[model samples]
Target chain A: MIDHIDSKIIALLGKDARMPNNKIAKAINVSEGTVRNRIAKLLKKNIINISLIRNVNQMDNPGIAFVGLDVEASLKDKIAMQLSKMPEVRFVSSLMGRHDLMAFVLADNATELSHILYQKIASLEGVQFTESSIGLKYFKYDYKWGRLLSEAK
Target chain B: MKNNLDNLDIQILDLLEEDGRASAKSIALKLGITEVTASKRISKIIKGDHCKVVAIADFEKCGFEFLLPMGIRVHGKQLEQVAEKISSLDAVYSVSAVSGIQDLEILCATKTLDETVELLDVTLPAIKGIKSITPAISSKVYKFQTDWAPLGND
Candidate 1:
């Protein structure tokens, strides 16, 4: 269980993942060794993933697409796994709605994004219908785990 | 290199991705550069908004039992307004304007199925210009991360 101390440590890293443990220890009023131990445990449990979140509009992945896929009901799980293997496909999820699977795709541009949808995704087996949504604006992209880490445990 | 971030920046990002709290001294040693150089580069990368590092709490452990990738198809010209409203809700971690079936996409999580239902049925219906709402819960997520690479490895 993530007690209040763990919550504070996680919150500090959420602010700046590269923040030194010593700084975090001082801020959270915990020993640096305690912070270190807790982090190790959290990582072991797969409770927290410390990774880089690049800003949008780079040369390679200048375009982002939200592809809503309606796949063969029986093959939803199977197809989702296949989609995950694609390099351009960033995130894959089996969803319940007009679409059976949700794929967050990355490409160089609009044309490339479209190509991925038509050539790559559309051609895949069990991908019955695909509706591609090019991501326009990201009003909110909070990776801070706000509610969970901010308030009291 | 891609965008304003170069190969070295990507390497640093990758090293840090492996260990978010990796020290500049350690990164410098790995990259075969001066510690000052590594720290300076990291500072610049952050200052330029090339990337950010954050703690991604465990959703299940955090008590977010139901994770819904909910889409709201709202009436014309109301997309931004409705999106702004949704962004205010704490459960929502992501809100983006996307093309296709849904005008707005939101990744919102709640502790219980009832709360999620309330978000779709009760809360959203109260909002104006909502034509339809589509909600999908992910049973399995194969890949979910935010990272870019210079050689197109990400």
Candidate 2:
């Protein structure tokens, strides 16, 4: 579990991952060494990952699609595993509702996205059928996980 | 503005994507450029709004146990209003106007089953323009890449 200090550090980093350690220390009222040590610990524990995320809207010809898949009950996990291995697949999750599995795919255009959904995803063993939704506009795609940590028990 | 990122910008992005905390000096050394040049390029990339370097916390570790993906059908021409309203919710991580059966797709993170149920049963339904909602709970997440694919291979 993380303390308030750690949470503050994370909050700052969530805003700008490359924020200087001394600046974060000054903002959070902690020593630079303390900030550095905490971040190192957090990264080592796999509790937080600092990385760069592109704004998908700014890209050209990027097609984003979410696919809901119906698969044989016994092969649900297997099918999810297969989908996870595909480069086009960004997120794959096994579900318990209308769809047994769901995958988020990204491609260059509608044609590429169609090829992925029809030619690749649908051909996977045990994939009964696939329902797809193409993303038109994204109003919010916030990856900052700091605020959520405040509510964590 | 659309990203007019050249080869050098792309390379810097790739390095930062691999290690967001990589120092300008280290990046300069690795890419065979001056530290000042590397620092300026980093600023240009970020100031241009091309991408953001941020820390992503693991949901489970942070006590968010549920990942709820909801398909929402809007009640008429209120798609924009409803999408914007839902986007402001604290639990919602993403809100997208989508094509196909559902008018919008939302991905939410919650701390417990009760919170998940409350979000689906009460909070969302209370919204005026939401026609209907189809919600699913993720049993196991195989992969969730925060990085957009167009920036890198695959």
Candidate 3:
């Protein structure tokens, strides 16, 4: 659980992910060392991860879409391995309740999307069915889940 | 360019947008600015623009089962109003007014396929001046974050 100080650190960091620890410490009235220790712990425990946020849409082939699959109980793993191998499929998830699996794919255009689906996904063995949706714009992409816990801080 | 952003400013913006938790020292080193200067500039930038850095989560993790990009072509002054209404819907994430046959593009996330269709059938068509809507469902997401890369000209 995040303590109040930890929460402050997170709050400040959320506002400026690139803020220096010393600046963060100064803002929260904590020592720089304390801020560093907390950050290290957060990272070690998988509370925070640093990664590149690339705009896939602006890339060489930028068409992105999400496909939800209803997999046959017998061939879940096989279908997953095959989809993962496809260069166009960037993300795949095994879900619960409604859809069995969800995936995120990128292609050049409508023609490319059709090829990935009809040629590749449709040909894979034991794949029961698939449904898809594409994203148009982005409004809020909150990386800090901890902020949701702080009563809108 | 004559915009408010200098080269270093753009670099800082790029780094923060990609990973909001980047340290000032690291950002400064990347932009060749002093850490103190970077820290001061970040504070100024946020204050000036009222922008906050955040993580872009995985849509699936947030219980959003469907991601649909819908293109809607509309007529007249009602375009902006109709787009605003659709964008405000709980399931609707983002809306854009584009060129050509489609004047508006909406990104939506929902729990079930039925829910998404219901919005299309019930809420969307009711909006004024709406000519048509075409849906492009994302089968997979390769990358969607808006963090533009820093300069590395060859």
Candidate 4:
């Protein structure tokens, strides 16, 4: 179980995973060892993972788009897994709505994106309908889970 | 030309990708370069805003199963303002201006369906100019990766 301190620590680490325990402790008013122990426990429990992740928007002109698919519900999970295996597809989900599966893909250019969408994803079995939206710009792209805990309180 | 990462910088990035907290000494030892050189390269990469180290929260572990994949249509020219408004909400993970039948696409996550409804039905409606919202609650998220690498250039 995570407490308020844990959530705050997670929030700080969410901003910069490389933050030292001492810095986190100073900011949150806790012992460095306490901060370190909480993080270790969080990691052990699979609650959080500190990773070196690239901010894709910062990358030059790499094609970023969202592809929504209406798949045969029976094969929804299978199709989602298939799309997830593709190199271009970064995120895939089985969803409940007009579209059954949604994927976020990245490519070098429009041509590559077209190839993946038409020749690759569209050709897959169980994909009943497909619609895509090229991301024009990111208004907000972040993953700040701990903030939710704070806001809810 | 203006801002580019050479092979050496890319290699250092690769090392950091595996472990962002790897010290300059450790990176230098692996790459067979001086610690100062590794540190300098790392600094350059950071200054260029090429990448970052971040904590990835597992919603399933955080006690949530999935996020809501939503498409919102906003009225007139209020799209950008509403997007910015939604951006400030912690319930949302991402908000993007997308090209298609829908004007905006948002990813929202919460601990329960009630919270999701509160955010979508109550809070979001309070944002002026939101025309309509179509949401597909995610039952399973197979893959979600933030770590990225630029395509190779010669």
* lDDT tens per residue, model 4, B1-154: 2258898899998888777667889999999999999989988875565676667667666766558889999999988899999989988878889889889999887888788778877998899999999888887677776666331111
Among these predicted structures, which one has the highest lDDT?
A: 2
Name the weakest run of 10 consecutive residues (lDDT summed) in model 4 chain A. Answer: A144-153
Highest DockQ, which number? 2
The true-versus-predicted C-alpha distance at residue A61 of model 2, in Å, is: 2.1
Task: Please report the TM-score between candidate 2 and the true structure.
Answer: 0.92
Weakest lDDT window of 10 consecutive positions for candidate 4 chain B: B145-154
Candidate 2 vs candidate 4: the TM-score winner is: 2
What are the RMSDs of all candidates, in order? 5.3, 4.6, 9.1, 5.3
The docking category that best describes candidate 3 is incorrect
* Tens-place lDDT digits, model 1, residues A48-115: 77766666644543788888889888888878878877888877877756578888888878788878
Across residues B11-117, which tens digit of lDDT does each residue of candidate 2 receive?
99889988898999999999999999999999999766678888988877778888888899998999999998998899998888889999998889999889998
Give every candidate's TM-score on chain A: 0.86, 0.90, 0.74, 0.88
Please list the residue runs of candidate 2 whose C-alpha ends up more than 4 Å from where it truly belongs after superposition. Answer: A145-153, B1-3, B149-154
For residue A77, give model 3's deviation from the true position in Å.
3.7
Q: Write the per-residue lDDT of candidate 1 for residues B1-154, one digit (tens) a residue.
A: 3466789988987887777768889999999999999999888775565567677786777778877887779899998888888888877878889877788887887889889888878887888888888878876566665564211112
User: What TM-scores do the predictions have?
Assistant: 0.87, 0.92, 0.52, 0.89
Supply every candidate's count of residue pairs whose N, Cα or C atoms clash at under 3 angstroms: 2, 0, 25, 0
When just chain B is superposed on the true chain B, each candidate scores a TM-score of 0.82, 0.88, 0.71, 0.88
Better of 2 and 3 by TM-score: 2
The lDDT values for all models are: 0.76, 0.84, 0.61, 0.79
Instruction: Quote the positional error of residue A100 for candidate 3 in Å.
Output: 1.7
